[model samples]
Target: MKSFDVAIIGSGPAGASAAFELSKSGISTVIIEKETLPRYKTCGGGFVFRGRKNMPFDIASVVEKEFHSIDTYFSKKHPHLTTTRDQPIITMVMRDAFDNLIVEKAKENGVTLLQNHKVENITFGDTQILHTTEGDIEAKFIIAADGALSPIAKIAGWKETRTIIPALEYEIEVPKADFERLSQNVRFDIDAIPYGYGWCFPKKNHLSVGVGVFTKTNKKINLKEHYATYLQTLGITEILSEAAHGFVIPVTPRTDIFVQKNVFLTGDAAGLADPLVAEGISNAILSGVQAAQAIIESNLDSEKAAALYTAKLEETILPEIRIGAKLSYHFYHQSTFRNIVLKKYGQFVAEAMTDLFMGERTYPADYKASVTRKIKEAIF
Candidate 1:
């Protein structure tokens, strides 16, 4: 058995960030991960500049593409609108590479990583103990940075509600000419299939074309077929490859009670992904930082420290996600109304949408306020 001041389950961004913060405070911290480092992870891999503003270390080395404009389409609706931004709005990278970069940083900061450790069970005595494949380890505090199906949060009996959204993605090697054209812009098609969106995100040598549908029943829409249709719509007929994968993602707003007793939860395990865009990398890292701060600020009362962390999230992040959920609902259902707004508002609408997408603004409260104000002014 090995003992540490803090133990983190899951070596994603949340866990790595928490470990980096804790280890820098001279606290003995250990990270347990079920999979080997640099595991294959499917994601949009789009990180906005706003999300990277406060990172603990430099991230330029891992960025695959930095996009300056966003083109949103409404294919399911009658009218379509495209929005563009003159400035860079999103930084795209591979999830495996980005996560590995952070974990390596945590290691460099003196955090011990227990690779290939699957947590069997976690129990809390005077101190917290984690039973894993390797052995048992004790810690004064534990953070569950695991993911949506966090074993640590479940072991602590922390209640959480997760709403699943089916997402299918692909890493396609497009023709050189197609790649050259896509490199200048990032394209998105709303309701491209149904109840979801399709995207063409450009990288160094390839384009990520994918779709996410909000269907409860697994009717099983052929993602590859849908991708082909989308490419045809874009006037693309080149078939380079058909490599693809599908996964489920939770979309509801996450809670602040992620921290409980001797345990705390972060990232997907804590259900922190934004319901609107399903973007979570930045949120994961932010939550990890807050978790570490809570531990370092913990004196005689750990509850107070946890409460502080929850407060910061509620005050800063939760409100935005809540609004994102509402806006996402409208975007999925009210395509006509969205098209009207986009065509009418054009750039203003585009910039605002970009702001919300980039985490620079929250659509939940501000969006409602805008609607109410418009109604009062009889604009609608």
Candidate 2:
């Protein structure tokens, strides 16, 4: 059996990022992926500048589009908001290429990759054994970064304790006129669906359009019905060619421990997608790095690594998500009040949101206080 200091399941952004960090530190790490490199990954494909700038290596080769400004339409609930910044607010990239690039970088740092290797089961002990269709490997620690439906996490004895919401995305090729007209800007239409939002992201040769229900709901939502409406809203009458895929995003972190025995969970496996926007790419990469760093800083001590990883998340990501979850609840449900706040302090709030996107600010603990102050001003 093959052995390493750490074994990572799934070669998505989180796993790839963790592999890159660990191998760079001269730690023995291996990435086991069930699919081949550059496989199709369903996502909004909007890589925000916050995540892009933090990447250690250049990824300009895969970037399809870069926007310095963004438009958000509230559909008459409030005034439309446009925000701009010096840095690109959102960078677009196809996930297959984007994820492959990161894995390649990790490989250069001597991380081993086993592609098309499906993990069948795991035998837990002080050193875990990962049984896969391809082969068996032993590692002192296991990092589960396999995305929303994480098999590794399940095998490690995790239950569904996170809030997961569904989304549908289409890679659409439209008529030249329609594509040209809509491809110039990135726009998000709020309330394009009930309790959800729709986005039109322009890619190099097509539009990546999707709608996601960002709030928690038990009622059924027909996403296709809403998607069709969104197409009409964007004036995309006909699609020359399109590929639609549906997936779920985990917006809240798991309430349980991130580490179990010798296993650690990162990215979607740990339910670390951003609560407000439901974007996982940025936090996926960040959490992966932190997990790897914890292992490294602990000098391969599993107990210390677990504690360090938890501390790392509590320091920022978890707290931010907690507040973001609360804010998202109100932002979607309290439309009347949200509109009131927006009407009075539209530009200020818009700028603040843009800053949050740019990583210039985190989810503000003082957001409530700021909104209270603005409401008083409006009332007076």
TM-score of each: 0.90, 0.98
Worst 10 residues of 1 by lDDT: 75-84
Give the alpha carbon lDDT tens digit for every residue of 1-380 in model 2: 99999999988889999999998899999999999998999989888888888999999999999999989998765778999999999999999999999999999989999999999999999899999998899999999999999988898899999999999999999999999999888999989987789999999999999998998977899999999999999998899999999999998899989999788999998999888888889999999999999999999998899999999999968999999988898888887777777887888888888888899998878878876777778778
Maximum-TM-score candidate: 2
> By TM-score, how accurate is candidate 2?
0.98
Superposed by TM-score, candidate 1 places the C-alpha of residue 125 at a distance from the truth, in angstroms, of 2.1
Question: Model 1 compared with the native: what TM-score?
Answer: 0.90
lDDT of 1 by residue, 1-380 (tens): 89988888988788988988887888889998888989978788888766776786888888998887777766543354454555468888987888889889888989899999999987787788889998998887888887777778778886667667777888888778877877777887877777777888887778888888753334666666777788887667786875687876766644536677678777787667777667788888888898888878875257777787788778876777677777777766676665666555645666777886565765646676775454454445
lDDT of each: 0.77, 0.91
Which regions of candidate 1 deviate over 4 angstroms?
A: 76-87, 214-225, 357-359, 364-366, 372-380
The per-candidate count of clashes, in order, stands at 4, 0
